[model samples]
Target: MKLLVVEDEKKLLENVAAFLERKGFLVDTAQDAEDGLDLALERNYDCIILDVILPGMGGYEFCRFLREEIGSDVPIIIITALGEIDSRIEGLKIGADDYLPKPFDLRELEARVRALIRRNQLRSEPVIRYGPLTYDSRSGVFSCSKKELSLTSRESSILELFLRNPGTVFSREEITDKIWETGFESRSNIVDVYIRYIRRKLEAAGILDIIQTVPRKGYGLRRLRDDG
Candidate 1:
């Protein structure tokens, strides 16, 4: 799973990121709320660890913007020194999934992150089907023609996005932001490379003409007759 950690204290940010990375998570850190907002909007993450007192935009406002303005349902955990009941209540009211106070135990934080991600995953459909392709989002399995296709984690993620939004052409930048790790070259033709890989696998399964490329837009799943 991937997580975004937004904290101003350099030591805290580094420690948190390092710990999470060691715990087998793709960790991205932001020094302030503005950069955090940008990363939150750009990439998809399993959870966001936010500090309530940020440089430019405050954590509460950032949470409200993502929940109300942008309609993002990504789980957010507000971490700040303010541990009062009112502050916790306010954070939850603004759509934070959980609140952690400063000086928290790293193990507890890890537990909360795992619990939040587990709850979020439970809310989503475990399996998604499109034409002859079947994907178990939880298991990270992609199958066609009753044959399970071996795919890398990134490849499976890209295919899941396409299956979730069939017929909606996604720009290369959008795909990069959603699928690739942070710092990936947005202009690279790697998106095309992955698309070619997916197409080859599907064709090997005797399924073709599923993924379609738009002239300038990028790629999307072709709507099939079996689509209801």
Candidate 2:
């Protein structure tokens, strides 16, 4: 999962990002609301952890912009020092899906994040079906003809991305950017390696040639007529 954390406290930001990264999430950080808004608009995140107290634009306004202007339904967890009931209500009214009071446990935050992501997936696209294969993004599980296919973390993430956007060609660069964090070697053949692994798994499940390689372009999911 990918997450954007907007918090001004340097120590808190680093701790949160590090903890979540250890939990297997790709995390991005912004010290102020301005950077947060820019990152939110520029990239796709599974969830956002926004701070109510920001240097400029604040979290409420940012949340409003994300909902009203950008129409992003991504789940947001508003973190604030103001633990009053009215403050929490205001954050919710501005479109935050959840709230975390200041000085809370990191484990609790992780739990909330996981719950929100799971709920969002269930509400959006719980099971993505392409051809005879079914992918449950929430569980990171893939099945074909009721038989489960084992997949590593990278393979599962890649397969989920492909199944979610059938027919959309993803360049190697795009795949790397979405899957790995910053500083990943651009020329690395990791994407190809994972693609080959996924293909082999599918082939073993009696599914053939679903992931089509677009020569010199990228890879895409082919919708087979007999898939239905």
Candidate 3:
């Protein structure tokens, strides 16, 4: 599975990322909320590890915006030093699926991730029809007609989000936050860069271009009918 770690502490970020990576997860990270939010929104991940307190936009706002505003259902695990009752309530109320207080056990964190993934996996049928593709979000697997292929972590995240909420127009800012978690550190042309990468991969596999551009806006993942 793929995960994003959004912690401001440089040492902690690397430490967590390393542990997760060692456990066979493809992991990425951000130093602060801005960077984390950008990466979270821009790319796709199986789970996001968000710090509650962050610079630019705080962790609470970032998590809230993602669920309430962007409508991303990507599982969230809030990680922070604040471990009070109210904090946990607030985090859960806003949309985090799980919460882990800092100074936590790495093994516990890994267990939580596996549990969440297992829970999510049980929610899916064998296949979900999204456009021409049949997606098994749980397995990170996709097939269409006679074609079958495994998806990369980034590919799975984008596809999963698109399938969950069909016909939604996603802004680059929105995409950046949802997928990559680099909301506030964008230096221009970055969103386009990833979009192009996604497009190339789909095309390389002979899949139709379901990701459509919106000129000055961002892109939308479309479910084109058999005729359309």
Candidate 4:
């Protein structure tokens, strides 16, 4: 498994990264949230170890941005000196999967990381097949008729949402809410644009009319013929 540790404390960061590396995990370290965000966007890690206090863009904001703005679901464990109930609640409430107070044992932290990753794994369906389209959640790969289908990150996320909910129709606004942060322009036609992109890709793969559009409603994935 892979992990990212973002801590401003020089010694603590080095020690944690070394320990995780020794534990057979590919560990990446960052001293601040900005660099942490860069690494996060660049690579997919099984879990992230974050520190609350930092030089710029505190951990809380970083977590929020990762979840809301970037639409990431990677598990986060916040390590902070604030051990109060309120602080813990705020951490989870803002998208952290787990929290650990500073001065914590390295073993317990490892346990928490493993548990969170295990829980996330159990919560996901390994492979979802709808008609000729198949999605592997673990690999984040989509295949049509046993052939790999290439998709951009945002496009894949949108298609994954539809595949997971087979019969549910997602209105434009609903898709926007689920995919983009609240600050996105309400009048933007990005949702429709993305739907068009996805449809074109599916069509190129010989999967036609998979994305059904309701007149006044929005879009949904409907089974075609006996492809299911």
Top TM-score model: 2
In candidate 2, position 140 carries an lDDT of 71
User: Per-prediction TM-score, please?
Assistant: 0.58, 0.64, 0.56, 0.56
Give Cα-based local distance difference scores for all models. 0.87, 0.88, 0.77, 0.87
Looking at model 3, residue 84 earns an lDDT score of: 88
User: What is the C-alpha lDDT profile of model 1 across 1-228, one tens digit per residue?
Assistant: 789999999999999999887665789999998999999989999999999998888999999999999999999999989968999999999999999888999878988897788678757868877878898767778898678998888788888778866777888887876676545666578899999998898898988999999998899998787434
RMSD of each: 9.0, 7.4, 11.8, 15.9
lDDT of 3: 0.77
Per-residue lDDT of model 4, residues 1-228, tens digit only = 679999999999999998877655679999999999999999988899999999989999999999999999999999999979999999999999999998999988887887787667647678888878898887889998789999999899889878866788888876775566534766667888999999999999999999998878888887556634
lDDT of 2 by residue, 1-228 (tens): 789999999999999999888765789999999999999999999999999999978999999999999899999999999979999999999899999999988878988897798688777987888778998767778999989999988888778777766778888877875567545676567788889999998999999998999999888798678634
Clashing pairs in 2: none
Candidate achieving higher lDDT, 3 or 4: 4
lDDT of 3 by residue, 11-93 (tens): 98898999887665779888787787788778988888889988778889988989989898888898889968999999999
Worst 10 residues of 1 by lDDT: 178-187
After superposing candidate 3 on the true structure, give the runs of residues whose Cα lies further than 4 Å from its correct spot. Answer: 125-228
A best-first ranking of the candidates according to their lDDT comes to: 2, 4, 1, 3
Cα deviation in Å at residue 161, candidate 2? Answer: 11
> Which sections of candidate 2 miss by over 4 Å?
135-228
